[model samples]
Target chain A: MGNVSVSELRYIVGPSSYDSVGSKAMKVKKFLQDYFPSQDYLRRLGVCVFEAEANLAIHTTSGGDLLIVIYNNRVKVVAQDTGPGIPDIDKALTPGFTTAPEMARQLGFGGGVGLNNIKRFADSFWLESLKRGTTLVFEVWNDDSTQFDY
Target chain B: MKINEICKTVDAEILQSKGRLHIDIHTAFAADLMSDTLFIIMRDEDPLLLITGVTNLSVVRTASILDIPAVMIVRGKNVPPETIQLAEQNEIVLLRSKHIMFVVCGLLYKAGIQGVSWEM
Candidate 1:
């Protein structure tokens, strides 16, 4: 992960066509680390982004975009993927529940913790998946200034 | 234990080293799942090592995200060149051992290295 001082960042990640999840996620983590002040917050955000990037890379028919918006009070992340959306969003969010194919399992992914991890880390989380696509949004506060009940 | 001693105990080959032989290691986390690895709680001063049988690039990526510093690939799995390259670029140490994951963890534990604390 390299550092670039910026308020926002976006990158397209895969349909498992390329092994770019780690590198791409690293870049996102580096970008956030440069601006975010809390180590704990950064770590939580890093885990969420890594999981989101992995999901987009492995599950989508076509790769998706990871959009990040950094603000004075909080940081927001949005992950969008095209086609073949999750039929059961609740089941997918359950820990230890996964529909990841064998290939993803072999790579040590699809442990069914991705969405839950995001939900756990983000101060606010939202997700929507239809027949055509899926969109996930979450935000983490920069500090303890704001807290929300999950 | 130090990196060199840990290597000797497991009979590990250093595929990539960042001159980390002398650094003391107090904690480690062993898992084949990158998702579980992400839940490991690592402090800035705590130099953690990752023990996994997985040979994919994501292993390195997970370690990098957690700042785990080094990875010990057990069961002598054939690692991809790109994974090694990524580790090199990130200055993350890579080690390979013929031993299985369980035995490697056992040896390290006996040598005073402890399992990492979890965020959960």
Candidate 2:
């Protein structure tokens, strides 16, 4: 039998809600900072994870769950929402393309680089969307010896 | 420069210092868009500061996440009490300036604070 250890953290983000998103992201950030090798890697991960959470709060109608799983060598983040899914993920991933509302822009988000930023920072990225929702899964490796593929 | 010096340079009112005035910051990024700020800071190596016109909990929250030592809210915007409280809890310095974002950035740049840049 293969034995593995995993630790997980989760947060429920309400759609169109702003206040709780940052706090929840902070919780994840604190947890990662303690284990990640470099503050630089942790900062990059924090921004990507925060963007995912913010996207869920801004785009979805019903909000979503942000899940973080910590393994010995990597951290996996999953942001899933049950809302109107992205119709054009390819276009949506383009830099400076955003559907975030005026309120989100006013809060200094919606620069349209959320997903792009996520892709840039993650060691591996995956996205799945349907009429009901979207789920983004990304992993960041603790070992920084290799150059990032992004 | 130290947080106190930056506050004086911008003529900002120190809303909540959290005893962080002595902290040194070497780089500054001014933007109304937090996403852009977040993007730039992620790649920066020096101690970072944020100058913005948005005065909400998100500003403080973003700084807290990135471990940014201080934030200056430009254009004399009113920062809510809750925002200040969050800053204090995070040990982030929060200040408000009468000058606009552009002017605040200029002042900091002239004061030997370098701007943030991408890692590419």
Which one is best on TM-score?
A: 2
lDDT of candidate 1 over A28-54, digit per residue (tens): 777776676566667677888898888
Off by over 4 Å in 2: A1-4, A146-150, B43-45
Who wins the DockQ comparison?
A: 2
Off by over 4 Å in 1: A1-6, A145-150, B19-21
Indicate the residue-level lDDT of B43 in model 2. 38
| Chain A TM-score, cand. 1 | 0.88
lDDT of 1 by residue, B72-101 (tens): 999998999988998898788999999999
Give lDDT: candidate 1, residue B89: 84
- How many backbone clashes does every candidate have? 0, 1
TM-score of each: 0.89, 0.92
